[model samples]
Target: MGVIKVLTGNYSASEGAALCRPDLIAAYPITPQSSVVEYLAGKVHNGVLDSNLVQVESEHSAMSVVEGAAYAGGRVFTATSAQGLALMYEPYFRMATLRLPMVMAIATREMTSPETIWSGQQDAMSVRDAGWIQMFCDDNQEITDMVIQAYKIAEDEGVLIPVNVCYDGFYSSHLTTGVDLPLQEEVDAFLPPVHFNHATLDPDHPISLDPMTPGNLLMKYRRSHLEAMKRVPEVVDRIDKEFGDKFGRYYGGMISEYRIEDAEIVIITVGGMTGAGMDAVDAARENGIKAGLVKLRFTRPFPAARVAKALEGKKAFAVIDRSVCFGWSCGPMYMETKASLADAADQYCHFSAIGGLGGADISTDMIYSTIQKLEDNKETKTELETQWYITE
Candidate 1:
């Protein structure tokens, strides 16, 4: 039986990690993400979660500890935020390239420049190409569920890559909501013990791990890594169905479409903002506008095929990005979506709408307005300029 409990997103992640039974947890404190580790630490101290909780001095060291532990044949976990994630980028990439299956929860926050510690997808978006499989959650329930599913996805033999469960900082991280906590026995049945026949620091079978590689050998490793990433979508779909069959909750694999059927315009959104974007689509529908929404669940694999199929016959569409793409003059997600739909670019009118930066609220009105703009310019057949939903 599942337990119905009201919990914050951070707590939900902690609870999910506990149920997944990580053998080791190495984490350093950072805003928005600190509570997730803290809660796990508490569980460890109370004997509820029997795991090694390493109190590291910095986020970089924290990741390094997990990498070492994971290499030693232990299921490991960690949590981080914006700057913390950036600091750990070195080992973060190495962990993925090394083909270590581990789960990390990212309470996504804005990267510093003018310096702000608030909710933003900039943290995760910045490392989209770092070899880790990344998935964003729309709410606390999804956060909890995806954290559990992440372990399954990462440990799959065909896709032995690290998985990052990212949720908007201060938004999903701090927000409290009801979540259906799964039973421990059921979770254990769902996720078996992780077994990897790769390089390990086992004393019995000692061998070199990550030794210096020649260009030809390194290219082979890179090619194999790309091949593993290609298997993610199918594996994610299978696991999502299996989980939903047992838990009665199904998040559409890779991407989830809301009312795309019989729609002429669509709005693409990621993470927590998808809820508001869906509401705006509902409003547009009530007002006689055929608007739909595409919630991007996985961004790392890019979901190009799924995205293209969803927006296939739509007259116009706009991607809502919470993080900027620096020189692109659009959001990171917006650039990715545009690239994904490049083959079908001439089929629909498209534009980018960037907003919700530095934890700013992306109101429904702003989303609705974006939909309205797309509907208004459906026949323009010209690429529209980037729209910023911020007051000067």
Candidate 2:
């Protein structure tokens, strides 16, 4: 068993990465995400953790340096948020395309123009299509454990893609809570030393890493990358199970459910606001509402089949998202959830609920109101308009 310590989400993430024993760490500090790498650097500089820590000029350089280190056969880690993530997009896309198995922590925050450094999912959501496996954490422990599991998932022979461990900026990032820090030996056993099938990085056997290719070949690479993504659901499930067996803490694989067995109405959520959603579910149940909650753990793969099964017999559902899908009036997760129920859109009553942008509060009352709205519209068949959780 590991020691239980009260740590903030950023410190938990740093400790998690250190437990895996990264070969190289590179990152440029940015709000919410800044303390994460700072914690790691402190360990390296204090002679407590043995690792090569590089202080880069910017998030772009941070990603580029780690990309090079990854190509040279090293297990690397980095993190950023908001604009930092925007800056890292160029090399970030390349990191996944090059099939580098690494983990980057995202202390998710709102984008600029309105100019805020507060909590929001927009930063991570903006880069969802950039070809990486992304997962969100509900708490500090999850932030720590997911980092360990992320490496296992990424380094799998069949799934050699990068991963993003995303959690809300001030909500989860700066929030302090008790986390059972995993023992080093146990983590070492759970995560094997990084290995690659290709001999490109090997000095004894040098070859082209990623040279210019014909459009036809580039198309092939794209397909191959997609095929690997299709395999991520199973990998995520298996790794979570394995982590559970070792640590005695199990998070239901792709999505976790709370009392959804015979629910007539359900509420779905992503990122840190899931707690509020669950509280709303409990409150609804007390008021004679058959309410249930489904937490969307993995967003990139969508887990459509699993979501379909979860919502199979439900009469209504509401997806609460912290980021907006400007293309539509609703949030991105709402749009995706609706798409998952494409054939049965008319079979159940549902709507998109957006809130928690720019550090806004997504209180239990807000979610329960959505649940109440779902109950009211449960008999209706078509999708309802988007609901924004605004408080005075």
Candidate 3:
């Protein structure tokens, strides 16, 4: 059975890893992400989790160790943050393209320039095209659950791609919250053991990995990776259904919609800020506004179809992103959402970007302001525009 406890988010992440029962864990500490490693370390030290806990010297070594373990036919896991993730970039990119099925928890923090260590999506965003299945989370519970689900999705036949389960630093990692820990038996039944076709150092089936590929062979591997990623949504839904049946918490596949039915305005968001956005929608509803929210938990394989369907008849939509696509006319999330809603242009669906970078606090007032802009546009505006919210 799953262990039940009032614990910090870091503990939940560790518990998730324990429940998955990884065969190997290699991690290096960085602020915000260190607690997750610490929790797993305790389990290893106490003999609760029988796994190879490698104390690597740096994030790069940490990822490299896990990559080696995974290539050796072992189920492996790891965690890191901003600079740590950046440091591990070389192996991370290869991990995904090679289809390693390794799972990682990345605590999102800002990239250093002026040298700050606060929370932001800049870390993960930096590797957007790294060929990994990235899933951003909204709360502690989701963080815990995604870790387990990520393993299942990555190891599935259709998608042997690595998965990145990302949650905000300090905001989701350090913050303590009440989260439901799934029953051990229930989770075990839902997730199966990792299967490896050909791994490095497998004496029984010795095979070369990342061999030099020339011409069409290189394109074929990239093609297969794309095909595998395409199957993530189906794999995700199947796992979520099983998770809900066992834990009573259903994360509606890649994106979860709240109060979109019979609504005219829909607010778009991803990660922890989504929770605040949903609450704001509820508050707006109490005042009789036809407002709703859609929290996108997954980003890598963007759910364009579902997004299009959700905004079919909506008059306006606003996408709140924690990261920006500076050269683009709007935030990355806004651009993705706008492209998804392209088919619904006949309904005059307007779009905008709000709140980004460095864990900026997003209040209900901010949500309300966006809704006001949408409602005000209901009567007069018909063109799409990218509006950035700046404090007066």
Candidate 3: RMSD to truth: 1.9
**Cα distance off (Å), candidate 1, residue 245:** 0.6
| Deviation from native of the Cα of residue 306 in model 2, angstroms | 0.5
Residue 133 C-alpha lDDT in model 2: 93
Error of 1 at 183 (Å): 0.5
Ranking of candidates on TM-score, top first: 1, 2, 3
Candidate 1 clash figure, as a count: 0
Q: Which 10-residue span in candidate 2 carries the lowest summed lDDT?
A: 197-206
Per-structure clash totals for the candidates: 0, 0, 4
> Could you tell me the lDDT of residue 109 within candidate 2?
96
* lDDT (tens digit, per residue) of candidate 1 on 94-134: 99999999999999999997799998889999999999999
**Candidate order by decreasing lDDT:** 1, 2, 3
Candidate 1 versus truth, CA RMSD in Å, comes to: 0.9
Query: Candidate 3: where is the Cα deviation over 4 Å?
Result: 1-3, 203-206, 343-349, 379-385
Alpha-carbon lDDT of model 2: 0.93
Clashing pairs in 1: none
Please give the distance, in angstroms, between residue 94's alpha carbon in candidate 1 and its true position after superposition.
0.4
TM-score of predicted structure 2: 0.98
lDDT of 2 by residue, 107-211 (tens): 999998698989999999999999999999999999999999999999998899999999999989999999999999999999989988764466787677788
Higher-scoring candidate on lDDT, 1 or 3 = 1
